[model samples]
Target: MRSAIWVGAILATLAIASMFLLDPSLWFAPERNTLIVQTFVAAVVAAQLTLVTAMPLAMIISSLRNRTKTPLPTYIVTVCECGAVFKSKPMFCSRCGRRLQEPQTKQAV
Candidate 1:
């Protein structure tokens, strides 16, 4: 679906570019009112196509962004038998060499 929209946009750009390149006098020709009107209609159609394609593209991008998950923060603290406070949990107390208690896990609010 996205590829189709891109192809349509590229084709519209090429058509508009070719229109101007093929007839530089179309803009200044007073006798070619019908050609000028056709050009304006084509431009309006191209703009509408762009707007229609952009809406779904924007929605897809926003949905993709919303689907991503952010990592949660963790907090750990341990107190040893010797009254030593440590910010991180360890296998044993640094001063007493005793096995440390299980670390408590806290969830962020």
Candidate 2:
């Protein structure tokens, strides 16, 4: 997404720069110069519109991707003899610092 913006900006810069570099006669010919400037302005406007539109489109796509993902399993609860309960079956009790026994868990639905 960031790369797309950079590419668009670079291309627009190149287009504007090339308009001056490619034609030295544009300075004398006011009508043709106006036309060229207008064309480049239109191109820049179109590119900006595309980027603005794409931001929301990309966000929607990423949100849909996240929505479709599977959820992780819930943690099992572990109880220490020191009367401390911990989730996810820790190696030692937090309060008493004693080693925990095997966690007794129900089946995940």
Candidate 3:
């Protein structure tokens, strides 16, 4: 989607440039001068608008994609040294009244 918007903006810019490069007389022709200028201005404006709108949209889409990719643990279980099991963390062990330490995660080799 972002690529398509970029392509459209590029094409609009190229179209404006081509008008001048392809026909230099369009600028000098009195009757067609106003129409050619207007067309050039419109194309430039359209390209600018496309880029302006695309930036925020691209940022939003990227943020949403990153947000959905993260996975959160549903539940955590902790075990105390005194053979006490807890569904939730506690400051002290219920069985031994000892300060409970955070469980260490074992890394895979």
Candidate 4:
């Protein structure tokens, strides 16, 4: 998709530049019918190339707008008797080699 945009941009730039750089007299010196046909073809090509280059930009913007961010998982902290805090709940305390206890809840009075 990106490559297509670059190619279209380069082609459009070249077409526009050629239209400006080429001498008008040269086209007029040729047959009148040929001049008109060539001019029309050049205009159409430039317009189409411009449209092609714009499509990728629109697609990228639309995709970005539709994007959603996912939240990361939350880890439970387990504190050991030795005062070592672990980010995740562990079966046993690392330092004291003791079983970790779950938090105690108060009974309703």
Per-residue lDDT of model 2, residues 47-75, tens digit only: 77788898899999999999998776665
Q: Residue-wise lDDT of candidate 4 within 1-109, one digit each (tens)?
A: 4555555556655664575567566545657466555655665566677677789999998898778644444545567767877777677877888886672222222
TM-score against truth, every candidate: 0.41, 0.47, 0.40, 0.33
Q: Residues 76-101, candidate 3: write the lDDT tens digits.
A: 67778777877777888888899876
**Which residue pairs of candidate 2 clash?**
none
True-structure RMSD, every candidate: 10.9, 6.1, 9.8, 12.5
Q: Which stretches of candidate 3 lie over 4 Å from their true place?
A: 1-30, 70-109
The best-first sequence of candidates by lDDT reads: 2, 3, 1, 4
Q: What TM-score would you give candidate 3 relative to the actual structure?
A: 0.40
Error of 4 at 20 (Å): 16
Q: Over all chains combined, what TM-score does candidate 4 have? A: 0.33
Sorted on TM-score, highest at the top, how do the candidates line up? Answer: 2, 1, 3, 4
lDDT scores of the candidates, listed in order = 0.69, 0.71, 0.71, 0.63
The residue pairs found clashing in candidate 1 are: none
Instruction: Score candidate 1 by lDDT.
Output: 0.69
TM-score for candidate 2, residues paired by index: 0.47
**Which stretches of model 2 miss by more than 4 angstroms?**
1-11, 32-37, 76-85, 88-109
